[model samples]
Target: MESIVSELEGTLVKDSDPFSYYMLVAFEASGIIRFALLLMLWPVTRLLDACGMGDCGLKLTIFVATAGLRVSEIESVARAVLPKFYMDDIDMEAWRVFSSCDKRVVVTKTPRVMVERFVKEHLRADEVIGSELVHDRQLVRPLPVIFHDGRLVKRPTPSTAILILLWIPFGITLAIIRIAIGVMLPMWAVPKLSRLFGGKVIVKGKPPPPTSGSGVLFVCTHRTLMDPVVLSSVLQRKIPAIKSELSNGDLVVCPEGTTCREPFLLRFSALFAELTDRIVPVAMNYRVGFFHATTARGWKGLDPIFFFMNPRPVYEVTFLNQLPHEATCSSGKSPHDVANYVQRILAATLGFECTNFTRKDKYRVLAGNDGIVSYTSSVGRIKKLVTGFKKVVSTFKPFIQ
Candidate 1:
């Protein structure tokens, strides 16, 4: 048995091109005929509709038969029929014909040799779908058909037919409705909706008085595309940072902009600072990794808008920080360890316990009780404690009646 297998492994075989078989199959299949009919019907139907013949369109009722062509022959024909399409200097029609075959053809010159080589090299079909041949040390002899199924057998049903039969008219109706609404409704409806739902203002602390003439480094968590918008609303001022590329045409703010490139961003930042007296830095904490800064995909192309808008008068340096969650888990430290470290750092640097670090419902909330603080929680209880202390101080103010 081992000797036979070894002898068979080294044998060579030849195969018919799979492309020819597929082209033949595609030519015969009713699905292909239906698609062709639809393609032909579209323009004709449009012309008829323009002439008040709204219901007249071609229906696929007959199958067109054609002579079976060889894969090589089809390649030449396709090159002549469609010269625009090319693949690897070979006519794509060849590939299409082969890919459409029902089964890949394989021919073995000797029974002792495996037929796999021929199937792989010449046919390039996912599977061999034909008979093997045996040679008695001299001439080729046909064996029983192997009938291997190719990958093409698992074709998904084409949706185009269904769309033409049922969904096309419905889609046209929906498009008409959309156009009507667009023309009839006020354009402000969209911006108003955006303001109501998309606009978010998160008050980290008391808003600075207008007369104070002081600036702050606004820091918050950055998660969604709407964070900056929300932050700007909360501040009630144009964020000094920058607008993202997608927000370019839509933004009302003049000074801020976003950029992906580093060199251009640095130069813009420097120039903006030179023109603005109050450089309000903005930062966000992303919930992944220990990196202090992240390149936001949406923020690219903001620098050009900022440069053109030109909303500055004096020079000042304002640093923006983007802190991702991964920064907490630095050097393989566990979440608990990182959380504790963050707590300590906040307490030391800010001179107060961190408060309102956890999210509640749709909004972030301060912890109400010690029991609410858990080791598994993403936010620390320190922030909550600080917020609570501030409320108590406000209640006992000396000038209060």
Candidate 2:
């Protein structure tokens, strides 16, 4: 708050009777307040600060470059610093006025990733311009790996473990109920569940039916942990893999291994070629959320579902032409070539840059992990007494939050 007050005070260079001048003032004031609140609440900022990044820190440098360190420099800095989580925790209350505003809405934000296609999400918005700050052109910040959402069986604290155990029957029961309804009446139930959970799915072009009996592989770009649910509801089918041979119906598959914020697409896995000829490449974008889940398929446990169910997520999907499935293309292309060709198609369709780096690379860099399970690691469990039956507390700090 002191920072906000000082920033505004420092920037007052001139006073004019023009209406535009006051409006400019208002915009600067609004942007600073919003960004100040955003910075204070962001866990990542706190984490970075804890790592000895005080005023002369990496984040402060980026923030100053994007926004301004001094009041006189604020407007010149130009872009607003939006935390990565804006999509997941959207405040509709804050956006309501903008949704209905008649004036030209220009969203200038930082970290180039945040503003990608954000203009398309709001129909009434006029323009948006974004910027990015990179350490040698790559915005890779080192992060620590946590066991929170990666594996099928997460090692939880005693309290959360008990809560999960208690919720098992409920989760199973809910899963069964939803599955029965979805499988029996996907055409009807999926849309209903989607709306019930505050999700919107937009599709482009005519695509094969989800119920098309036979082998069909649905491929698309990734965005957010909520994707599996949105994709499941949008396609009206679960894309789960099975060794039981899915020679029968349509099965959807996400091409990019995990949700990504980078403009580039991760390496392609030729899984579609291994399946039947009905390989459909799709382009996907999301209106909200940035926390990309790093765990592999079938590894994430139920608690991960908690984020998807948090309310307000939107998915936009565009299906492209089916890839050539011939053993040899007309140009004598192998299956590997065919896979790359499909990746190109998907990239061109969605405006994503194609890259060879795996999602694990992002996980390792972003999570500050060695990317290998620590074997032969042991811990001594120490507990503190609790008043009443409240539960025990551990004195040891977690590796990562």
Candidate 3:
């Protein structure tokens, strides 16, 4: 197979006449016949349903004739009509213009011998889709498979038959499982979890006067996927923009009131800063990275649509005051270390009393230093420790010394 591929690669011509280009397009198109037939079957079925029995039969006959005509007659017509497609001999001026353009170009030819050679030698395109040709001596014979990376990659396979044998039943099973999960899970679970983690509130830099709309930005840390969810639940409003793919259901579990548009997410942070004081920018401080992981610049080029979106203001939150090395503290200690550490920082910086205590009645271990626990465990321990410290401090009266 490798030797056959190498022989084929060696025969690839640097230039081709018009006849070769048409053959390539036809060869590539033949590989998709089965998939195309399957897709056509649905519309054909619908047509059959709408028509009388005689009409339905006629429609099926027409479909067969149309497909047959394409296979038998289209090639000669296409070859005669298509201009002599040549890429290797493209003038230097044309090459300069083509190279400067940001958009991708599709080069089509019947057999595409010249296009394939040009692609192999010069174009490092994201993708290439073209037909194949078999050559014996000087004669070109169109092949069933398209050549990619010097390999006959695409072949005429019974795609519909394979889909029926494998994919259809699997797809149905998947749909059933998806429906079960979607129906069983509570929609409120996200909000409830967010509220449990100190329901999102506008972290004010300074107390503001009584105003109907305050431009509030919530700057938080980003560590886990749950961070954004928790913050959104606390805020009770959607983050203005999200990744465009997420908007299109690429990312499941869209936040309530949160609509993600790639363009909007890319720029809204800065635009919001300019438009209204009510704009709230929420960011997370990860202990590892010195800055918030999500930033205006980071969002650029991530989505095609983001380039056109309005810019919004972004505020950074350095919640974890200490660096990661400082936060690691003594290992082999109880999880209580986490509680104590958090409490100390809050008390020192925010002037809030934070403590660690065991929730004996709940039969839960509250705090210890082992970091290798679930997020739930860490949150439970932190809450217990902070609550306990606050209680202890409330009861103490500083004696005049």
Candidate closest to the true structure, highest lDDT: 2
Candidate 3 Cα errors over 4 Å, as ranges: 1-33, 36-110, 113-165, 176-180, 188-273, 276-401
Model with the higher lDDT, candidate 1 or 2: 2
What's the true lDDT of residue 260 in model 2? 61
Output the worst ten-in-a-row residue range by lDDT, candidate 1: 260-269
lDDT string for model 3 (1-401, tens) is: 01112111212223322323323233323333533453445455456656755446334533432344454233322221111223223454444444454432334332343343333334322223445442222112221111111001112123423433353354344434432332343434533432332222234333222223323333222222234433433343333223332232211121111221111111111221222222122333222111111211112212111111111112223233322333332334333343344334433443323222222211121122234463356456546654553443232112100
Candidate 1 lDDT over residue span 2-38, tens digit each = 1111111112211221222222223223234534444
List the candidate numbers ranked by lDDT, top first: 2, 3, 1
Q: Cα miss at 187, model 1 (Å)? A: 5.0
Instruction: Report, for every candidate in turn, its global Cα lDDT versus the true structure.
Output: 0.28, 0.43, 0.29
Model 2 gets an lDDT of 0.43
Best by TM-score: 2
Angstrom error at residue 121, model 2: 31
lDDT of 2 by residue, 1-401 (tens): 01111111112111111122112222233443433333333445446668875433434434433353354223221212111222223344444434444433333323333332223232223343335322112121222111122221221222333444455455545545443444455354666775654556787867776554565666767665444455555665455433133466655566666656545677777665666666777777765332222332122343234333323445677877766546324446655676787778878877777877665555443332333541111001101111211121011001000
